[model samples]
Target chain A: MAKDDDTAFDQAGFDEALRRRARMVEAVLRQVLEQRPLAGEIARPQRLIAAMQHGVLAGGKRLRPFLVMESAALFSADGEAAARVAAALECVHCYSLIHDDLPAMDDDDLRRGQPTVHKAYDEATAILAGDALLTLAFDIVADEATQLAAERRAALVLALARAAGAGGMAGGQMLDLQAADAPPDEAGIIRLQAMKTGALIRFACEAGAIVAGAPAAERERLAEFGSAIGLAFQLADDLLDLTADAGTMGKATGKDAAAGKATLAALHGEDWARRQLAGLVAQARALLEPYGAHAAMLADAASFVAARNK
Target chain B: MAKDDDTAFDQAGFDEALRRRARMVEAVLRQVLEQRPLAGEIARPQRLIAAMQHGVLAGGKRLRPFLVMESAALFSADGEAAARVAAALECVHCYSLIHDDLPAMDDDDLRRGQPTVHKAYDEATAILAGDALLTLAFDIVADEATQLAAERRAALVLALARAAGAGGMAGGQMLDLQAADAPPDEAGIIRLQAMKTGALIRFACEAGAIVAGAPAAERERLAEFGSAIGLAFQLADDLLDLTADAGTMGKATGKDAAAGKATLAALHGEDWARRQLAGLVAQARALLEPYGAHAAMLADAASFVAARNK
Candidate 1:
């Protein structure tokens, strides 16, 4: 998506635009998982598929996949490529959330205003659900459902896998667990954010662009857009943790403070973090300008970055 | 594999082959997963990669991946297909082993005569390791490091995913946990065996041929080879629980009986299970002959099916 600064566009109108696009993502995901009926009883491993669908359907704001779709639209590519990549991206994102909410990790009992996977099912099923989602993401790719060429599809799969695997979200998770004792200094936070949040978002954009057959420079530009917006999204999340209500968010409010968890509010102080967040949103918006007209939706997404309460 | 009469091959010779082939599986698996030094502070996810490697490397008979390789060789394919599929199959099988050994499931403290994954590390790390391995299996296909065609790669991914997912292994697990009060019917036994053991072995053999560009009929033949052997493998396992020593088997014997777990031995008595097992092995061995000269190695594997303890 050409990342235009949507500060010039209708703010409410752009917000509405994103909501529409978000709906598209949900529709696409449901479409891809639609299968013919099965006969007899399903075996064990197959249970993971249903478990994955259960967790994913529990709902969250479809941001990562939205990013891919928005970015693909910015490139003037049809929604076909964006739709496929977005489904896979959502699978990875949903898997991460499920594992992160497990009893042994953050121990979250709720997400998006619903019971966590562990609470809804048991821990073992929750574990398998996460594992299945991770596996299913690649299954979707290796299924050749993507609109890209085979090599490009492979590239997309590799991108998502590497990001989600030991070096990416998994690495971030471990680091976050270790860092719970003391918030890392600036570099540590950056490294943590890079792995935990940046990798998948970056991959989402790049994979979508690859699907759209974007030129090398365009792919790089989309990546730049992804990194900036991705960080901004997390910064906003930190702010929301301190400011949003639990009921509104459908999650525990200020649980970070309750658990003595480290946050931007604790480390940088609220004012400084908010100021830095504003700067991040601005940088994110600026990154969209090069995509010209194509970046309208992305620019609006950036604008929303500073304002979303939950 | 076809159902066979009691007379198929020399039982004594076959036992030696299972022992020998199991060693080859171990060697092949170890050779692929050897650690290469990483550049930086290997992230937490990377640690999972290490943990997965460590857990998988801790060793078993390497039977599943070996089955894949040997079944592939039934088509006279080269080493490359066998080796790659071996790695892929091991990733899925070992991932299952890790999850199966978790605290929330069987709550076992030992595996392969060593600490189970949760005991080896923390429960969280073990969970992540299993998750990583499952993802890595798909990543292997998504990365498509081998010379497989796009369509073939997709098929392998779907097959493996389905094999390892709900209808395959996961479904079996659910049945296991949920079917504790289930009546000990013959169909119930067959259902459990198909999901728990039948799925991955079938995937392994079929994947090898799919990767080797084998024809559809031959792939079906390979699957039958896997199916008959898989059923036999489980039966043998049930039998060994009654007859084998801990030192030789490398696991705590009599635990199934102690746990009151249902097994062929529990239902049909040890003697009947044995006769049934011999018949299965003969049937397993016969499935490979259709490959003719290309079938020798697979026939050797079939012999190994029951020869291990004969």
Candidate 2:
């Protein structure tokens, strides 16, 4: 759907790259837990460490964090520094996933075809894992990637916090609950989509650019790309929730209808949902024209948004 | 139960003072939030701001943030700076409250005479509210406060994140779940409380002093005060869960009995629980001796911790 150019993006290579990147992220994040002055390390109590590792390591598309690394690579003098920036985004993303999978939230039993964190461990462990990941996101930025200006880095952390926070994903989620049963027109749906998905995606792209010291103008452009991609991502997701079967999608498929969700299927119908997704993908791709040579991976990543089946 | 020092502390005034302090904390928090960029501020379409405000101001003890401001005041700081620090702690405390109220964790319906965040709003809002509060806590700390040193303030922010995140309160919560219906022992109970309760309390005191530029060596002494009061506070909470009526408590009471939780009461019986509370109160009060004249309010606060019916 996002294929503006005829050249096929390396889907296989991108998948492979994401997997490798996720492993590296897990390695870096685990290093945080392992560092010791034992008593000084905030009393992790063995079990907590196990639970966190279990959730964070469970496989999924490590898209946002990968974008963090990739976007940083656009300007970072050091490749390793870019990787660390990437790792920070992973922390934020993983925390969000942990919360999203909780019994009280999305209530999914399966994530990435494995037991959701709450199912793999317990609800409390899942909550802690999410909290740890969220805090550790800032800790990593503060401790490892201080190459950015102190105030600026603080701003980046703040940016991530605001995006992933109550007003961002959390707020979006609340709107989502209301939109499911309440009357929300197209604008309301768009607003919910922007927050629930766009906030983090924008943060990921912006964080990358922020760390590498991209100009405000370029950063804003990248943020636009992120927001566009985020909307397309959700359009695809709502479509998937309706169309994908359990065997292919891993989780409970078509649960959206049962839940009475006002998804894309309900609003635009299947054909129009597909058409709207394609249009968003085109717009997302168009935003990348200025980044041109620099944003190849991000462009590829964005283009893949509506095209990917799962 | 801690009334052995009844002549030393005033219950009514302290309660009233605490209430006044809590309201002040909430107001200051609202002011700090206004500093955020309006573009990214919560959207009205989602009713995100309303949900965020509701979760936070739904009435809490605000003790931790109060400790932050009070500790800062002990060093003769500007009133505005102290208010910012106090409000930051309240943000953290409120986040924890929102998450704690979720069905996945403590599963309570009421908090402070109102419906829990999840109940009044929805599960998604409650999660976001918690996430938002946690994120905003760091945002406040990282933003420029009038008199704080960047390095020292950073240390305090890092400390709070550690305490609030995976390794501290979160880790404790995980352990709390793991310990449920398993076994009851003194060491286990202590570990649980220290993580769940002690972490935030310790940060509250230390963050205040950090902002005020208390010498690093002085932190150890203040930490002792925090540690003692933290335990006493938890003990008081556990006891309240056992003895307070639902009407007076504003939530379901005797929940420990219903859930068969492992508190000191569940572990050692009510007689042993009271005796242990007495011991902790003495230990808590003893740690404040060095504060001299100013310790009266702090000490009074500790005694009030013991005497509260709910």
Candidate 3:
């Protein structure tokens, strides 16, 4: 591990890296969604495919995919494999957002400054689109094109399923919904946020570790790094909701508070929340310190999550 | 292959076989759902779990799982592995039914003689429950407990995803919803039914072959067999919908004609449909003849599907 004093971390370099990886992910995702494997068996339903295209092709920063790439880089995992896995993560993330934006859930019409899937399409289309995307994520991970060893792919599929399934993201969303009825304590809120958003983020990092065939200790450490940063990401998000408007955030702001949902930022004041975010980021960086320059980008990721405007 | 004069297929034997397999699938599903893997990470979210339980535990014939096990039996696959895989197929089947019964889709109040998931819970819960069950299906198949080679599991995951995703069940559903605006012709309706219902049923059979490590030709043959029975199953369902009342069918009857949906029975009349069904059953049975007495239950299954009252 190189000493910190060897070289300063470059924020611009990290941004460029993120942009390059995001483009790779975008291209892969386009090719993936373009596939009509059952061409002769069933004519691909145009409207459903159109809705899926609408749901997935809508752009975001692709932060989670970037995390996947950077984490994989720590062990020099295959770039194509990492990219495919990252795409899977992004699909699950996007699907959750679509479901969350439904009238029965967050009821949001806007996402990424455009109409949510349910708004752009009807309710049933939105529901099907989300469901299809979720299924597609697993499909991508298990695809032969991803080109990992079978066991490794199975491991990826298992970890991903757990992260995205009832025990992880979906369960977390359920808790979030129930919180609206009876607001949870601060601990409950943290647990909910951890499951709702953090679980996937954590999986993104652990996924890289799995892809890289890292040892158990290393995998655990990277996962811990992810958990810290996951918390930091959501905390930063809560802070932004309090501070930013729709124009800057590209979605409704302060809806969490309006819904009377307890958040760390809501429970604590802005100053304390800001301090907590810094602490979490620092903790994340320290966890990555053993990898030194190999983890420089990941350190930047934590900082970026804390500092992003949107 | 068995000769025509070899032996008579027994209806009673088939009924007992169906009952036995259904019971095995039900037991496995109950155990699978009882799991609380993330107990420490998050509270299991009882309402969501309950909704999932309600959706899956509501009694049905377990025909899909039976197909999975029976098809696997031809290759003498590991019984436990087949059972687990069958459970996963059942999860997908139940999830689809749950979503299909939602107010946004079928608006069904009763399913299997009880209030639908949405009716028993709420629209949001129903949606989430369906989503969770779908996720759980993949999880179970991907799990090490299934004990297949990782490559086989990956194949199963990929196949299941395609069968359940845009090119298959969900896409078929979108088309079904749109059919209300522009009712399809016979070919179009057949295509839609093949995808919407037949895809998963086909997967159940193909999954069995995959589990048994059957060759490509055998897998394709079983899949074709699945397609034949899939059509027969829908034809039977449509016939029952036309003939049976809510008391026997356990849900509203004749809703398809009311919705102006074009089923074979609706388009060709009951007599033509019955003849088509018998022909399909004969076709399904013929496909299994090569397996001899080993396929007696399957041949009986085909006849049973045609003759079923509900």
Candidate 4:
């Protein structure tokens, strides 16, 4: 384990760490979205680049990236490489948000308390911006600056692609869109949530292991930990959507309910959902127990994910 | 050169070869887009998959894939590997087409004589399908089935990403969208066409070299050939758009002039565009001259691209 892994976990400490990592990710993303074009590129359209920056630079907890960083730290992975991977993951996350907020999808005007990409720019720009951001994620991972071995870099690309592709996040989005016409049953909702949100979060943790060249056993363990936290994250999100106001959430809340989308948290009632979150956080922490002190930050992350208000 | 390189490059032979390679690419693409989800995926949403198939499986010449296959053949690369790379390039190409046909973009209802994805399905499905296809392209390249060294796979991913991302195809699309409001000058039109269409074509030829583990000089040569052909391809396309009817082109034509979007061919008139095309084909063939008989098919391809009626 890295020396940094010995840091004690506390609510304030975890929050501070999350913010710091968000800043790190933001800095990397800002550079990635710079005005100058890369080699083999003709020119970067100002409107497209501006739209991409608007979608990605908006503030959030950067929870997914935090998971990548902390998970990598547990495996003693290179911090710089982990940061790039985190930023790449965040790009995928942000791109999905941009697309999901398009008029044909969720159709929201506000995101992170600002006009969504489609609202700020035209719909065509927003679509292209999202496409470009998604492509840029792979570019970042496969670039030499990530400083990983060729094999590790290839593995990262494969894993990230799977998590973000048809059978994963995008597929999940498709299911979510269908949910309005035919609300899913409990099992279907779980599957939808797992694919929609869990896959990327799982990849975030697994990416650390891939970057560190950790053993398969360790990779699987981190992945399982990720799965637990992923469920908890979604359940918590659904819970917030049910109870929180748009002002508190920064985006519109109660959207799932309005769309008649069935969520486990909504279906089983808030009480049951809270209990599930508790169990999931516990399950997530337990998976990390084998790592002892090195897992402290990850353990804190699970709790934070479940308990975050917005 | 392999034994296959000895074949004569008559028009019939070249057309047959192109069609053969297109079939190979289509087969690979079909398998890649199958209903069965890959590992780590929860489920493949049916509607999204169908929409993706509708977008991709619609028949075109598969010119980009053909370029990749032929370029790889120049270096004696594995045929199967080349085919996979070809399919991946086609995915990016198809994704761009799907998104570009959206109401917010080109607003076209027809593509290749069939209803566009958004017309056949809804706009949301079309968007998701495009997004998924783009993501799947990287997934296909990075997969072990490509049977390349990890370093080569990573390079392919990097190159493909750069070609398809903000500074390349997507960036070009943005510029093309903006062209209606502010038509580009001659130089600007060249840059826009290069990014929007040339980047992927360039990547296609360079990919064969990358897959074959060809040396830098060889790669550069193929890339330059690609550039020459790419410009020729766009010029030919612009000419056709100005002269051909929708019944012949199988999609809208003369839209560049209608939309007030400048193209070199449209700006300079038919005679100049034809002269430029002839020069570009000569330049392309000259780039491949060192390979002698081995590059005969590619030489033919340059002429074919510049002279194709549709």
Highest TM-score: give the candidate number: 4
- By lDDT, the candidates rank as 4, 3, 2, 1
Off by over 4 Å in 1: A1-11, A28-51, A76-81, A145-148, A181-183, A245-247, A258-260, A263-265, B1-47, B76-78, B181-184, B245-247
Q: Give lDDT: candidate 4, residue A139.
A: 97
> What does the lDDT read for residue A173 in candidate 3?
92
Q: Candidate 3, B276: how far from true, in Å?
A: 1.4
lDDT of 3 at A71: 92
Name the runs in model 3 displaced over 4 angstroms.
A1-10, A38-41, B1-9, B38-42
Note the DockQ of each predicted structure: 0.44, 0.42, 0.62, 0.84
List the candidate 4 regions with Cα displacement exceeding 4 Å. Answer: A1-9, B1-9
> In model 1, what lDDT does residue A37 have?
19
If ranked by TM-score, best first, what sequence of candidates would result?
4, 3, 1, 2
Q: What is the alpha-carbon lDDT of model 4 when measured against the actual structure?
A: 0.90
Q: Per-residue alpha-carbon lDDT of model 1 for B129-224, expressed as tens digits? A: 777777666666655554566666666767887788656776677667655655447787788778877788777767778777789888887787
TM-score of 2: 0.85
TM-scores for chain B, listed for all candidates: 0.85, 0.90, 0.94, 0.96
Instruction: Estimate, for each residue in B113-178, the C-alpha lDDT of model 3 and write its tens digit.
Output: 889999999888888899999988988888888999998999999899889988889889988999
Runs off by more than 4 Å, candidate 2: A1-7, A33-42, A45-47, A77-85, A144-149, A238-247, A252-292, B1-7, B10-17, B31-39, B42-52, B122-125, B144-153, B238-296, B307-309
Q: lDDT score, residue B78, model 1?
A: 58
Reported per model, the fraction of native interface contacts reproduced equals: 0.51, 0.48, 0.65, 0.93
lDDT of 4 by residue, A160-247 (tens): 9999988999999998889889998988998898999999999999998998999999999999999999999999899899899878
